[model samples]
Target chain A: MKILGAIIIIAASTWAGFEWAKKLSERPKQLRQLKVALQSLEAEIVYGLTPLGQACIHLAEQLPKPLAWFFETVNKKLEEGSSSAQEAWDSSLNEIWKFTAFRQGEMEVMRQLGATIGKHDRDHQQKQLRLALIHLEREEGEAKEEQVKYEKMIKSLGFLAGILLVILLI
Target chain B: MKEILDVLPDTIRRVIEQMDTDIKKGIEEIRIRILRPLEIIVDGKSIIPDSDGGKHVITPQESGQLLNKLSQYSLYALEEELKRGYITIQGGHRVGLAGKVITEKGQVKAIKHIASFNIRVAKQKVGIADRFVPYLYDGKWLNTILIGPPQTGKTTLLRDLARIISTGDIARKLPSFKVGIVDERSEIAGCVNGVPQHHLGDRIDVLDACPKAEGMMMMIRSMSPDVLVVDEIGRKEDSEAILEAVNAGIQIIMTMHGNTMEDLFRRPSIRPLLDMGVFDRMIELTRANGPGTINRIRNQHGKEVYCKKVI
Candidate 1:
């Protein structure tokens, strides 16, 4: 029984560490994909001149799961006639961040981007989009560096901490 | 009615929705003004909402919210419509806005701080043109002009006439003709994403929100419509295009803002066309028995061929 318990604890700790490391590693790629999604969204706004609610819904169809849910929720709130564009965007972003690996500073850029979106002409909207793209791209680079620097450390730390706990308990 | 109220901000909609069923059914327009009581017009009479001996006034905040809702929270997307001073919403309803006008080099730049809105409810009266279509049709389609003053049912009549000509009523055995409408204001077709809300029939093609003159010529070249229809032709270019359409052998049916034949004669843009006998039949509408009331129809000789007494 003691040997079986030891094996189970080690296996669970290793799995948890690997999962954390994997999530950390995926953050940079997710941010980059989000930047691409936003670039296409800008195309829809500038070239197609589609309404904001409609543009968001269209983007939701093409983006990945978390970002898709983000846009889909914004579209729903906009169509409901209850909230303004900024409000809908801000709330949706807040709700979706938990599902994503987006950091707080990255989220601040999105909140600022929401303030000017759909409020001005095509030129102004495109300007806002470009600004957002710049911020996101910069953040994506930082996330990549952070992932490379700390992902392995997180995985190893989890394993070491579990081992320490098991040794202490024993 | 439901669509109009749905688009309205909650404060004003609540008052309009509580109106009597008869008033709601016949409601023509709902006007909203900042810091002013909500008012609706039924048949031509204005009804202001009052509760407990106090009028239900709209606040500035409510007006802003209403504007946002009407624009669907994206004012940038509706820039062109805003330039035209109105936005066409779902259900073919039009909400006209008025406010401070910003100009640049003697041209209107944009309207800012929209302080008032007039929501005109659209009701499509199908087959409303049945009584008058026969008079306009005499074997070959006549180049007809419907003359009516503001708030008259000129647009409504024109819309129905287009539908009937395009669909060809089976009961009346009227053959469908390929019809093209130059809906300059997007009012006739009430198009949402280029899809018409009203049934203009399968044989109809609409150039929604295109300028009348340009649209008329474009329709002629591309659509090759058997009958070309337009609303409110009063520009010099419009006359030039109409002359071109007439010479191209396409029949024309159009409306202009006028109370009588005299109004058409005095209007500078259309006066020359009238003198040139471009219009074969001139139909005058009045509010005598309500909108779309045909007061008289005249021939090219300016003789009244049909009058209200005969009808």
Candidate 2:
């Protein structure tokens, strides 16, 4: 029975560690997906010259789930005509923070992008989007490094710590 | 007119809603200026919104809100319309904008800080062109030019004429002609979502917001219109296309900003058209009898044909 209990505890600790590692690696994936979305947004602005509301809806359909919902929320607000693009974007970011893991600096870059998305000429808007993409790409690089280096350590550490506790109790 | 009020900010809309019923019906233009009193023109007289003859000023924030609504919160999407100095909303109403100009290499790039808006209501008067149709044709359609000053209802007359020519006037027993209109400003047809709101007619096709010169030739090549109509042709390029369309055996019905025959001769762009005798009939309109007033009609020889006043 004691062996059964230790196995259960070790298994639980290992599963929790694996989940933490998965979450730690998820930020880079999210940021990469966001980079892809921003590139498409730049194309929609430059070539299509589509209105922002329509553009948001189009990009949202093309992107993945939680990120897709962020754009859809902004598009809905824009169609309502009650909030400006910047205001809608800010609110959408706040709403999605619980579902996604955008760091403070990354969120600030996106907020900066909202200021010029639907306010400038084609050339100027493309430049603003490029700036946001650059910021996101750099952050994505750092996140990838962190994910690769720390993910394995966190998983192994949880099991080892659990084994040490079991030995002391026995 | 109520549609125009619906697009306005709540503060200014409330002021217009509170206006006298009689005055509200005749409201022609609603002029808005940031930090200035909201003004409405009823029958050429300006009326400021006030309880006791005191002006109700609109704050800058209110004007910002109004712009946001007019632009649907995306100024970038409306950059082209903004460069043209006007935006057409639903119901065919035009809102004229004035602001600090941003030019690139001496060409207008965009308008910034739009401080004033002049909302001009679209008024359609059906059958106003019935009397003029008989004068425009004898056996076949005549190449005609309508001369009028601003605010003289030339556009209204032209729209009705296009409708009559396309639909065929039953009272006058005129058969419908295939009419093609190059609506550069979207004023004549008031197209919304690529469909015309005003009743033009069965055989009419409109190129909404297309340039006059390119659209005229495009209509001729694609639509093969029996009668081609364009509004306010003054540019040299426009004249060249009109001459080309006339050469293609298409009857031309057009309007120009001129009040008299002398005015047509003085304008260099139109002088060549007159010398070519391109126009078979020339009609002049005036605002002497509250717009759509027929001042006179003359043949190609400049001989006056109509004498009595007709509205």
Candidate 3:
């Protein structure tokens, strides 16, 4: 009965300690908050998209073809032992990122990371986070552009209808 | 036969090293008659055969043994060379293999055996078949048959007939009819890959290395010629196909390996064909049976024309 009581006490202590450690853990909180904010931005754009806006959003949401191909080439170059994986990855990224205009605010993060993280362990991690944020911003920007185009098309249609009504009256 | 081999190039022996048993045996009996000795051809570069310390007298037995070492690819190539009709061998030998044949199926197949090969040094008798040319055509064309035993110049005459029918000679003055040759045996055209190696004439379109019945039908479809020339019709399929061709308004000039018309009646497979009478003429050849030469040419309605008697 004493051994049983000791076992119960150890289990309870372990459970309490785990609960305390979890309360102290900040990494989960940071990651969860970051993911939820990024996802919310995506969901807002999806819901607000007109047909043209949705199409443009879909295009912006896609990983750029050249960038994907660049990553694949680096992986191939690493396999062929032509260059180090880090070097290959950095060079390929530079080639691919040339097309990406580094903007401030939502986009400055990508430019800052691209400038600072040339070839380092945290470089890839920094760039990956920046790319994800930038791609989300691009989707939003394209969706807004599509909204403008849709407005122009509707205005032109309204103008055409007005002209037709005048002609019918004549 | 020895004379026949004389025309084959020295390189051909090595080319046929991987030949089958029958061909190897056939090569063993061939002799060179054209090219001079001490010739060795390796991939077209003429080197000298070691010949065991400069012994030039390579007998046919030795030739056969040497040929057994060649790859089968070379044998196929050698067959192609033979299909071209004539080539000089290691010691200036001449050989003939392609011919119209009566295959076991009573169909026309190409003859590849250098059997009945004659090496008469290829004396170009320009007007060899001149006298017999006019008789082959009866108003339109008398569907002729050339019958002879092995080596009795049956192929020689067949080749000549093809030449004459395509480009008529000056004396007989034939109108050069459109001739479709099923040269499955390569005899009439001596074709190598559908190109004539011998002078089968410009009017002849040949189907080389094909079965005779199939070749005949193929010719009828493609050429649409008035007359079709093929050698050796003994296959039931060939026998039937020839009848089909005749029914389709195509005249056949063909040959069979037989001494008498009775030989055609004897075969159970060819018997039905004989009764059907696709071939309207029967030409009996005999070196011993008659005063000799091309003995007799008889019409299907039972009339005979006697040629020069071989004394």
Ranking by DockQ: 1, 2, 3
Q: After superposition, how far is residue A33 of candidate 3 from its true place, in Å?
A: 56
Kindly provide the TM-score of model 1 when superposed on the true structure, using C-alpha atoms. 0.91
C-alpha RMSD over true interface residues, each candidate: 1.3, 1.9, 31.2
True contacts kept of each: 0.55, 0.45, 0.00
- Using DockQ as the measure, the top candidate is 1
After superposing candidate 1, which stretches have Cα over 4 Å from the reference?
Answer: A1-14, A155-170, B262-272
Q: Give the Å error, residue B43, model 3.
A: 32
Q: Is the docking of candidate 1 incorrect, acceptable, medium or high quality?
A: medium
TM-score of model 1's chain A: 0.90
lDDT of 2 by residue, B171-260 (tens): 666778999999999899988656887888889899999999999999999999999999999999999999999999999899999888
Q: Every model's Cα RMSD, please?
A: 2.8, 2.5, 26.4
lDDT of 3 by residue, B1-311 (tens): 33333323354444334345554342323323222343432322344333435524444433332222111112222433443454333222334333334344764433343323323222222445666755667766778888888756676677777777888555645577788888665555655445776666788787776789898888888879888888888878887788878888888888888887777778776777567665677777765642124877776754676555657
* Candidate 1 C-alpha error for residue A77, in Å: 2.0
Residue-wise lDDT of candidate 1 within B89-197, one digit each (tens)? 8888889989988677998767888888999889999988888877888776899999999767899999999998898867767789999999999899998778888
Q: How much DockQ does model 2 earn? A: 0.46
